[model samples]
Target: MNKIVQIDPDQVEDVGPLYAARKKVYPQKVSGTFRRIKWGLMAFCLGIYYFLPFVRWNRGLAAPDQAVLIDLPNSRFYFFFIELWPQEVYYFTGLLILAAITLFLMNSVGGRIWCGYLCPQTVWTDLFYAVERLVEGDRRERMKKDASAHRWTLERISEFVLKHSIWLMIAWWTGGAWVLYFTDAPTLVKELVTFQAPAIAYIWIAILTATTYLLAGFMREQVCVYMCPWPRIQAALTDEWALNVTYRYDRGEKRMSVKKANDLRALGQHAGDCVDCYQCVAVCPVGIDIRNGPQLDCIQCGLCIDACDNVMKKINRPTRLIGYDNDINIQRRIEGKAPIYRIVRPRTIIYAALIALVGGIMLYTLATRSLLDINVLHDRNPVAVKLSDGSIRNAYTVRFLNKRGFDRVVAIDIDGPQDAKLHVVGGDSITPDRPMIVLGRDGTTELRVLVTAPSDRNPEKSIPVKFRVTDIGLGEVASATDNFVAP
Candidate 1:
């Protein structure tokens, strides 16, 4: 007994414009516990990024000596003592999964901690802001200079030039450091200085430099507010218990001047501790009023908390009017109850367990993975040929990888078609009775091979064939399966 409902598609109107113009945010600077933490983290992150490529590891003479490198030319990735082959790309997949789960776990306990603290965008933007503050002055002075019409004095012009020059230098270094991960850092540096590096290297550096300059210098908060999808995702993933930078309206309502609040308290009337100062908003990188409750524009950076706490201290009142808080805590405060924290909840536990499980699996696989590998592909045309000696012959392309540091002699054998003999097409060193070839150190070799079986012992149609390759020096064996066909 349901009524049918129909509407014309054209009848619906578009609600509103999909986008809005951006407002520039000139964030004021503040200092406190969070600021100090930010400074330390920024230094650590930038130091590792810029200097780690130069750190050498003793990886013998033949291999790259850098601690970490992606040798695209050789199709290898070297990380300290560990080396990865092209077939082992799944390790990167596992690492990506671990990183995602770790981010989720971090979010379940502390909302947007990645965005507020560790995100590359935030770190670079913070560095750029530090440079800007150093050259142009603090928030108020910068704002005043921008607002005045006749402010472009020689000193201002000089500051502008200096600030931009420094920013460009930092950006160039950032790009330059990235290229070091692909080659010998010292060698590449020498080549780059002498204009002898490859054109592609220069192209990549230029692209990265432009992006870093634009995104960190000009886009800044705009990238956090409008461009990034993490804020939206974090909002969806957050629970009531996830601590975020919050303004406690319970203690901040009925905001007034300090004298007015004191007079009201003396008269036995309620007056909020907030002095209606806009310091919190002023220092916010996104220029959001945290007092207006949770908003997507708020990055939970904790700068407002520092600004509000400083203001509260100046007024001789209780601090932490703004702090790392949650909705449940806010509600508890409203009901005159102590706030509770539940960091070990179901979601957090699940995320942590997933991270641990994936990490353990990856470690186990890496520890026991085979260093020798083989692959076989049957010939496409004339898969089987009748030999003049009344024998059935089949051609194959065999590829083998030697993942060890030294050379290896691998003996190849076939396990199908009775009385079958193996032969390498152009290898003079391989014996007709027991075919073997030398595999180079840490490389792959492809060779054409043939298998012949007597007509009396040949299979009728197609039969499963197993190609086994045994390393004579290391006693390691690898096998691959293909099909043997008879004409």
Candidate 2:
């Protein structure tokens, strides 16, 4: 891969204002099985994200007590049972790949499940809606209250204040919870309250707070419809067989009043189950009519299913005119054939296999990962130096990471040269010149070393030399190889 070195690693410019003005989104409050599931997931996700950093796991006396931590200062990631240094960043890359693949799999089977349920935007937006309903009222009441002005009497003022205050409180808490993941949570909380936290911490809190409030409280459904890219990609990825919150227009259409439909059915004319109550549209958070034939704006949250079911129950008709279904299945039903569902289609199978492969690889690697790490850099500019006695020498910068919680002795040696002398600067060369080096607990140390080969021992013009680091305490060995150049 040709690296875009000029691209700033942390900077991606926002696509400039595509729309002249932001459209207001007043997501109607919904109650149904899907809404309840969304609420449960929201609470669970937020609970874990906000409080997990406070949970502790002991890793002897050397590691941080936090269960999950991203220590930017020390360049370490600590989970409940795993500690990762900079060298282990590849594991994170692997995880991201797995996560992306899982998202694709979810899209193939169910269509943007992440967007509908697990995405932070959706969760937070749902939370904001709940708060709004509690403080103000349901959709009709809220819309009515907004329409009238002096209706913003003292009571309205109090309710509005209470609502915004709660929204901001949640936003603030969300921001506060985020910073806890980076440091010791209990101590950081105290420091933050006393205003002793770092400037960067405060800056990050402000950024998160503003974003959470705006995105969840103000932007709401517009974020899903316009701001998020998933809907557009989901539209592209979806097929005829993928189950989505679909309106079975085959049954729901020829729409008319219950009395009118009953009259037509009695007369032996075409009639359908729908009562034309518009409950389905009213309950939709995204506010798109599923009867409009699966528009991009529909989140498929399944609130319509609940509303239609309720309507069906009240009117003594069949439920689920709008349900989790697919075009192919609808066609089959229309043709008087049994509807078929293939959850194990090629797309879904590929995605599941990839997920399994990546998950297995990650599990295996995590189970058997080495506790020690080593890195080597050969000195440049003067690749080789001719010693006084005519032995050719190469200098190397060696770094060793001791992941264990106790100090240990390590023996550094060279393996490729038959008569080469190894010197660990500031180290003991005792008992057959076994260069002794010490590593601190859960820390890294760098040392300069000189490897010299006698003129007669130079096997080739450029000989590959293997540098071996062996932990005396555990017999664990790691090696790096580089070419030794001859003058």
Candidate 3:
């Protein structure tokens, strides 16, 4: 039998708060292969974003000349040579799928490569940090300034103002560049400067500006840790084989000073290379100690690797105390075996294959897509009408899409019951039985059409009716099928 004992109320310990206040992180600047790579990528990304709007593509007269534009008013999306109508929204869907698969493939090979190297947040935040470092000084200087009791000195005030001003300018330009993609870039720029641009454009610019300033300038790593869903997603997607910014504990355990490590090694005792300098933590953008093992907060940006490598070089130890490595390699090193890498594994292969397949399909469809199209909608109120001449008639609204750069004449014809007479309400026939209509350049035109069948030939049940529109000059053809019903 067990005896039940009652605990005193005072003996119970108080529980700690569930949430902790955010600590300000001041990431130090470091330079290495990864840092150079990041700088190159940031420049490339920003250059394309800020300047691509000004690039022009010759799409004939009366068409948008901007290389990339989202002509929302005209319900069109243009990218260099490709033009997409609203009906081709599936292309966007395919693009989204391709992006997701590429991200997965990157994650499967190297953990959070997108978050580390190419994420807009990471790039912008890095830029903001650079501005901060330039204005306020490096990690130690900034920390000393912030920690001082006299927080409002003249020099400090000037630094704060300068840093924030630069940040705001960058944010504003980022917003401005986004709006340029929606219209004629040079015209919009002039209108914007003259204060004659549309209110909606200014409103969007303001919204984006505020968000970019807040997220990149102040939120910084908090955006990566608590806000972005990709970190959590990549955490789940990462595998043991994936290379992450990791500390090789096998070589860096038993942290001690360089002098002590040297003495131990000389005495024929084991001494790990790590010196516990905290440089890795100092240079981390997310303020995580990679030595503490993989955490969700670690973006795997590899700055810590640079810091550790620098330290190792100074201490006369082998570099890469922290490097792009996996748990499997760490274990293999501990077991006195050579490290192995598997970049071409099953998951990565699958992701690559899927991306290729989707990309191929989209390219093929775009290349072979029809320039002319038609859609037919049957009249609802009266499905069929009985004419005075003992004939059955069906009315339809036919919409013709001419996706060409110039106006074209198209002849329309209908095929249904034998001896069917086709008539366009406001159009004249270029031929005896086919009505011809002029289609505007890269536009849609709708017409009311009537198809009449003789009473003797009219079907008792609804039958299929096909409408064909043929371009008179190019001989391009498009067709739509509806139904012909008896009165």
The runs of at least 3 residues in candidate 2 whose Cα sits more than 4 Å from the true structure, single-residue gaps closed, are 1-30, 428-432
A best-first ranking of the candidates according to their TM-score comes to 3, 1, 2
lDDT, candidate 2, at 157:
93
lDDT comparison, 1 vs 3, better candidate = 3
lDDT of 3 at 463: 79
Off by over 4 Å in 3: 1-12
Better of 2 and 3 by TM-score: 3
**Local distance difference test, candidate 3:** 0.92
lDDT of 1: 0.90
Ten-residue segment with the worst summed lDDT in candidate 2?
A: 22-31
Clashing pairs in 1: none
- C-alpha lDDT of all candidate models, in order: 0.90, 0.85, 0.92
TM-score for model 3?
Answer: 0.97
Q: What is the TM-score of each candidate against the true structure?
A: 0.94, 0.92, 0.97
Q: What is the lDDT ranking, best to worst?
A: 3, 1, 2
2 or 3: which has the higher lDDT? 3
**Candidate 1: tens digits of C-alpha lDDT, residues 186-205:** 99999999999999999999
